[model samples]
Target: MSNLNLSLAMGDYDRTRPIYDGRVKIDGVDPVCMLLSPEEMFFRAFRHQAFDISELSLSSYSISVARGEPHYVAVPIFLSRAFRHTSIYIRTDKGISTPADLRGRRIGIAEYQLSANVWVRGILKDEYGLGAEDIVWVRGGMNTAGRPEKIKVDLPPNVKVEEAPQGATLNAMLAAGEIDGFIGPRAPLCYDEEHPHVGRLFTDSIGAAEDYFRRTAIFPIMHVLGVRRRLADEHPWLPGALLKAFTRSKAMSDAALADTSATKVTMPFVEDNLRRARNLMGNDIWSYGVDQNRKVLETFLGYHYEQGLSPRKVDVNELFHPATLESFSL
Candidate 1:
């Protein structure tokens, strides 16, 4: 039988570039890979089901899974992960010194269902007793005027959410102090530009993130690799093949990043940061497989349900394909 040809779409991270450049191959498959931004890849994958395999937002995937039969099923290849402590940006003038201070404040979000926001909110609630209902949420794009949640979400009634005023954006709103703060994956443009008043809520974000990890042991997952349900069903081996290939790609990237003689990435402190991460989280810092990440997945699913993104708490087993849940050991 001939190898199956499939379309694959995901962000162009070093971990995935090996697959894009043909150094890593999916078993029994010919992949047509498209390097895309997270927004484009996710919107097309979830909303349109446009690719055979693509990167999916973990929060959005949970929502789809909770709503019943979804178009895609996920493998255990976590394409993106991060500590969301750095995601929160606040106006310095606001008296918001701690996460608890966010209560009764207006905060801007691109979308409430965003995985990063979900993690941030979960962290706030878990670490500071600040629930989603405690704040008034203003929804809009960070730089642009309007942005809709890629997957429709019906949040709990008590959780207040409002649209940004027409012709306004979260970035401008944060800069003008219209919104007390902003929380999402990417920092607001004003914060990046060093606006005097716009600064991260955690002034020492790295220190905060390190402390958070020390306490929780959760390096939050943002994106999961997904295959069309129909395709996975038709070719039972597809999901496992994807998991293998992506894991190999990540290993290659890790090896390159660890090569200190000539740093692989453009970042200045690659070796120092890599040393610190390994010292804190061990060698397999960015691990794949369900068994390795079950706790993190469980935590995110709990948050997803509590925050009203998922209709009900989704099981970690339900979030990934059975084939990916176990593997043949050497």
Candidate 2:
């Protein structure tokens, strides 16, 4: 019997209970600590070599794959929940009204290589003829930049990159007139309202993606759950266990959104959001199944190669094992 002590990382502890509770009951697999973010997961996975990392932020998959470390399972988590749309924030004083107005202005992003960053940039390039060379790019975190060699997209030449703490950095820079606009997931943009210095430019990522996709017919896969390769090779059952757990969690979250009980009274908006998430689980948007996930990774690799992100082309078939998808069957 495999004695697997798995450490899983997530964005929020409260939101991850579905997976935490479900995994504990799996035989031979033990879930240890549930981390709070991708950054923490990366640090712990690399910093502490004690416990084997079983699951972690999907964003970290690219890097983990590069290192050939733990077994990785590509599970779609936040993209289905969050990426249906994204928000762009700009100062009202700048008089920037549309995507076209963003030209020649400084844009703040949470990270340069984040999945959202890549999708947003791709949208700009494909729809508006904007490339990384068109705007000044300011990055929020140092580690947030993904492996350029793994996934390359063309960036504007005039881009200016910087690192700041996730929450306060963008607002501080906007208040000080350091940047003209900001692009990121909706939560950070929404949370910035507390600062009073920044204003929203656009409120929807889905709208932006829709406009872009209408023209391009291509949708970008943002984030995915990554498991280490080593652990996966040792214990094949883990990947299926993870997929089953996440699927259950997704269903529970959906049911919770539909419930009228007082416990769910505060989360009415989440119901519609959950339904949208369920719809996104379709073949086009969600890729929990193995073949579907491989296609997504291959698509990214192709984009990265065409955009000059990687030097020698990588075979998508080699990056992840085929069995990673069998978890959905469990």
Candidate 3:
């Protein structure tokens, strides 16, 4: 039988490197993997269907799935995960010292539907008694001008959102205090450059993130692997095969990371960080599959619906290929 030819667009992550480099091969498939930034990959995938497989923003994907216009059938392969307590930036001079201080303040964001922003908002609401409707949102680019949301969003009537003033960017708006704070995956240039007044709401973001994880046990999923819906429908075996290859690739990555004999990665403190992460998250710290992460998915889904990103609540099983949901025990 001829092997399937498919285009897979994803990030240049350590876990996915083996798949891209051909060290890990998908069964019955010849993949043409393209390593790309999440911003570029997601936009093209969702808007143009430019690839057969791609990384999808969880928030946007959930919205599409719940609305019954799903362009992709997702797998539980979480390509990107982060604790976004550090995503929230506030003006130190504005009398804002805590998460609760964000209420009624104008918060700049690159997109109303950014996955990281969604997670941040959800965390704030769950941990600090703040919700989307509690703050005024200023929507605009992070560093560049005229940035737009990749996916369309229809916000609830109670939430107030305004477009950035003509030619304004969130980085500039936040620094100038035109907006009281900003929240997104990307840090504002002002914060990066150490602008005096721009500071993270959580000064000890890592500590805060760890505490949140301890309380909630959610690492916060950002991007999910998606296969073209039509392709998934026609080829029942494809999704499972892809998952097997990816899971194998992840195993290789984990093995390399755990091998502290002579650092396998270029990053400083790789050994120490790996040990610390394992200590906190246990073995399989970056695990994939539905059964292992149902609570995390359910929490995110609830947040998606609560924030008006998803028109209605969606179940975790509704997002992935049916074949990928379960496996047989030998």
lDDT of 2: 0.54
TM-score on alpha carbons, each prediction: 0.98, 0.72, 0.97
lDDT of each: 0.92, 0.54, 0.90
Which candidate number maximizes TM-score? 1
Q: Write the per-residue lDDT of candidate 2 for residues 257-285, one digit (tens) a residue.
A: 56645446465566566566455444234
After TM-score superposition, the amount by which residue 126's alpha carbon in candidate 1 deviates from its true location, in angstroms, is 0.8
Which model, 1 or 2, shows the larger lDDT? 1
Task: Point to the candidate with the largest lDDT.
Answer: 1
- Rank list by lDDT: 1, 3, 2
> How do all the candidates rank in terms of TM-score, highest first?
1, 3, 2
Give all candidate RMSDs, comma-separated.
Answer: 0.9, 5.3, 1.1
Clashing pairs in 3: none
Question: Over the stretch 22-128, how does candidate 1's per-residue lDDT look in tens digits?
Answer: 99999999999999989999899888999999999998888999999689999998899998888999988978898888999999999999999999999999898
The TM-score measured for candidate 3 stands at 0.97
What is the alpha-carbon lDDT of model 1 when measured against the actual structure? 0.92
* Structural RMSD, model 1: 0.9
